[model samples]
Target chain A: MTREKIIQLVNQIFIEQFEIEPDQLTPEKRIFEDLALDSLDIVDLVTGLQQKFSIPLRENKDILEIRTLNDIYVLFEKLAAEHPDIVAKLNKEP
Target chain B: MKPRIAITGAGIISALGNSRQEVYQKLLEDECPTRERDDWADQMYGTYQPFAAAVDLPVETAKTISRHFRRSMGNAALYATLAARDAVAESGLSKEALQSGRVGCIISSTVGSPGEIYASAMAVLRNELQDLSSCQFFKIVSHSSAFNVANFFGICGVQLSPCSACASALQSIGLAYEQIKLGHQDAIVAGGSDETTPIVLESFRFLNALAKNPDWSPSELSRPFAEDRCGLVCGDGAGIFVVEEWSHAQARQATILAEICGYATNCNGSQISQSDGASIAQCMRQALKDANLNPEDIDYVSAHATSTPSGDREEASAIREIFGDTVPVSSLKGHLGHTLGASGGLESAIILEMAKNDTIIPTKNLTRIAEDCAGLDHVTSSRPKRLRTVLKNCIAFGGVNATIIYRLADF
Candidate 1:
């Protein structure tokens, strides 16, 4: 919903699924070189992000231009801006 | 001359226990490992049969494996990797020899985790296939067990994975022996593994082939060769062995456990569901012929009697026609229940123990032998027997029958 929530959820996927450390997941950290994930891991990354954010990301052509962890945060934030309904629903206190 | 095959090491994880000694101890104590699962029936669609089962999962051992490999593994693959590690450790194979490009891997399973398949199918039906885990396909493939075993151990040659249901383990072991006999490889890790999923239990129940727990306790369900014997009780586990060429093992000065003298596998070609004695007898006869030994040379017979009425009858009748009520016969299913694909490797390990310890484990719960399964010298109690030559018979669905012979090799 917010920048902090988006960062928390995206970093959680990297930590849990790919066994990356929290300190290593900086905004400027390159996902491929710093995270040690090869090309084979991109499919799982996309699936994990899509399932987490509840958005269809495969159709998004802009995903090809992504490089760093900050790019992921920016993309999720942009999507949230486009769909205000998700912001309200995700931000509502459970 | 064919190169002799030596079983240098063995490992197993079964309902009875994690090792061959534990399985033998439980069998000596006359304990049954099958138990009831309270949550299992809910998975079945109103077709509950109270199917008895035994499941021994090595959660701690499984956690030790790397996630890169573990992510693609199911229960069967994990069990196999654990067992293979134990077998290799006991063999004391050096890293140089292990990675020398001369070793092979042959692991078999009835199928990949049916539970993963069921879950993936549900995800597909719900139109969430794109969100599925990328490694899900690797876990559900038929060669998952073999590939996982090879990748974990770094084995480099002659990889094979057979999916012949109950006969899978024996077929894999037999293939390993053939590989060594042909001088194609110096050694091979051969075995089979399986997992106890709700679907496997329910499918057996639908075919009236699963043991039920009604008046009797869950432990007393699998009664192989007995008159009131029920059908097979499901159990999950694995068995893997290091089969090495005799010259190679001798050169390495390895501790030889047993010598695989003979192996023969054949298709019944007549019935896919039911077993016939004539074809089973032919399989045994072929193995004996391969070993150049007569029926009398076999001191014991490890039968594939899974507590099913007709299957036991056919196997027993075949034993009578060939061995003729002698050579002390027994089935481990009486204690371990039916391990399906893992039964051959697991029971073969116990048979090696029988030779090494000079203690023959009798068929548990065989209080009174059935009339149809009579005429064989059915062992009813543990006794002292210096087993030299032993034969293992494994019969599976789809008319697959396998027979393997072993001889004690004095170190």
Candidate 2:
């Protein structure tokens, strides 16, 4: 998926998970501050993204470093580019 | 200047019941609350078999006088409030004590408001931000339970929320004990609560940390230190106790359950999940040293075993290293599940009750002791035993290990 497409999906996930509005979920929105996502929420978010996109998002040492919406978007986009088919499927969905 | 502290009052709401007497009675009979399935099944990734000693908290209990109380308070906070109220009432400390504003409150939770977090997320997904209530935001915060309990009881003194994973409750009580002994406050209400949530269950499932025995009933699900034990079952509940200085308690004629003799806490500062045996042992040693007691002086140990493979093994090793092979070690998590932040508080309360009743409840479902858990005298079945001093140990997710020494009240 493209950067914009990945951002859209991330935004959608945040909105769905936290009842946040699309406009409120800025690229700079911190998970805990803006979205109120706790440690478990972050783990679930990554897990859900991995399952939905069929990407291998292993829990690396740096996995805890992802803090902002933009950071998550970049990670998702990078993964999507590596798996075009998965990105295509995600993009095709409403 | 460490003053002797006394437990003036205690209250609890578990799958067992709302009051201490109710929960204690149920525990004596080895009764447990039912493990129910999650309502949001499809949304959850793995098979969720969550069990909680859930309290039937009325809406009014959660509702605050402030207009900001619109958000649905988390089950943890709701339960904390209930237990705190009961604790205050049982202490028989007049409103003047609270009005004096010298009272403090410390509440802890392992996983705070998983349901609220999930609900908030679902709301965002449904494009329902405006529909969401204000209380939703308040519930998701880590300190929500502590804040709510403090507010509910009008306790204006030093308020704290400790999130040491499973050890949150113990640390909370330990800190309260310190505050009272140091004269920071005359009285403090402290304990912990946990609510079963999908995220907590799914996280454990992903790590393959939950039991998956179809034939094994809920009561038999958590087999801590058992050789054939698969994993732990998620159980939820809360425990709160009223702590005061010995002189204060005696002056008020408060019923003393046990004396908070000593406390010690240390962090491994290493891995986030795995237990460091050396640090765990050191914590125990330090607590014993602080209490001016030897390893043999401790009559019982309420272990921090959650039935997880690595966790149970590490704790077992630590116990053997510290207290030798003959120490009677047991975990209430097998009975109450891992109440997380509330585990420390709940287990401490249970241990005190055990000391008072002169009986040690069985480890519950420990059928075969694990090979790694060998050389330990674990109480596999409930038996009457006179316990004078009990050591309660708790370990949390962030490499925090805490131990507290409680002595039976000598009147």
Candidate 3:
């Protein structure tokens, strides 16, 4: 998946999980402030992403620092570039 | 000059019961509240399979406090308000006293509004942003319980929310003791409340800290200090005490439950999630030293054993090092489960009642003591004994440890 596609997918997840408007979820919008996501919410979101993307996202430190949809999208993009098989797996679903 | 502080009134809502009399009676019978989650299975993140001492509180309690209703408010605030109201009523302090602004409230909780926050997150996922209330964000903060209680009681004095993890409740009470002793307030309503949330349960589960059992009985689970104890069950409730200057309570001829002799709290300043035996020992000694009493002078100890492997071992070692094997120590978590923020307050109230009744409730379900937790006189079976000076200890998640000394109430 491309960067834009990844951002779209991440934004969709945010909209679904946080009821955030698509227009409100900008590249600089903080996950905590803009979306009002807490530490536990962030953990659950990361877990959901890991399962959905079938990618290994172990380290709580890096997962906690994710602020924006773009940050999450970039993370997915990097992981996808490294593991095309997982990207294919993630893309196979809706 | 430091003023003498006393516990004028106390109230509690636990798995055991709602009122003081109810909980005390249940404790005497060695009965505990059932811990089941059949009613909440349909909710998101509702797969918590642990014992909880949940309250059967009414919704009118919340509506009576504030007209503004939001799903953000959890059971924690409701329990705190109920206990606070009972404490104020029992203290013989009218609404006029509360309105005078001479009273403050210090309530603490481990994680505030976990259920509400989790539900809100699920709502957001469904693209339902318009339904979220303005108070939702405030409820997610750790200070929400304190803020809600202060607002409910119309207490304009100093309001504080201490989030010292499991020790949060005890720290709040100890801080209130110091504040009243230093003439900071005429009376203070202090305590702790906690509610079981899926996030809390999952977090503990992820850390491999929750007790997983095939049998769904409350008595069999939460066996603190027992050799076969696996881990602690997650329970929720609130314990509130009316702490005031002895002179103030005496002037009003209030029923004094116990005298606050000495209280001390210290930080390990090392590991965040682990306890340091030396620091724990030092904290106990400091509390004893502050009270000007030797370790042998303490008649009984209410321990802070959460039934975790490391926590139980560390606390046992600390107790043995401080008071040796002679002191009769017990943990109510075995019966009440770990109420987290409310453990200290609930246990303190239990000890006060025990001192009054001259009876010590046994550490229920402690069949075989662990070898590491050996040496100390762990009160297993229920028995009536003479009690004078009782020491209460609490340790929390942020490396915080607190100890308080209580003398039997003398009319």
Question: Candidate 3 residues B1-411, lDDT tens each?
Answer: 557888988888786776777677788888877567666555425455444556666666545554332234577776777777788888987677776778888988887767777867877998754345545676777877787777776788878888887898888998898888778798889989888765666667777777767774766777778787777777878888888888988998888888888888998999788877788888889889878889988899899998888888889999999888888989988778888888888888888778878878888788899998898999987767778898899998778999998888442
The lDDT, on a scale of 0 to 1, for candidate 2 is 0.78
The residue ranges of model 1 lying beyond 4 angstroms of the native Cα positions read A20-24, B47-49
Cα miss at B177, model 1 (Å)? 0.5
Per-residue lDDT value at B33 in model 1: 78
Candidate 3 chain B — worst ten consecutive residues by lDDT sum? Answer: B63-72
Error of 3 at B84 (Å): 0.5
Task: List runs of model 3 lying over 4 Å from the truth.
Answer: A1-94, B39-51, B60-72
Task: Identify the leading candidate in terms of DockQ.
Answer: 1
Range of the 10 consecutive residues with the lowest summed lDDT in candidate 2 chain B: B63-72
Best model number under lDDT: 1
Docking class of 2: incorrect
DockQ of 2: 0.02
Roughly what TM-score does model 2 have, to 2 decimal places?
0.77
Query: Candidate 3, B36: how far from true, in Å?
Result: 3.2
User: On residues B1-411, what C-alpha lDDT tens digit does candidate 1 reach at each position?
Assistant: 767899988999887778888777777788787776767778886856455445656567777887777888888888888888889988877777777889989988889887788889999899978877888888989978898988887888878998899998999999999988888899999988888888888778878888765887777788889999878888878889999998899998999999999999998898988888889999999999999899999899999999999999999999999998878999988788888888899889889788878878888788999999999999999988989999999999999999999988553
Interface RMSDs of the predictions, in order, are 1.3, 10.9, 11.2
True contacts kept of each: 0.57, 0.00, 0.00
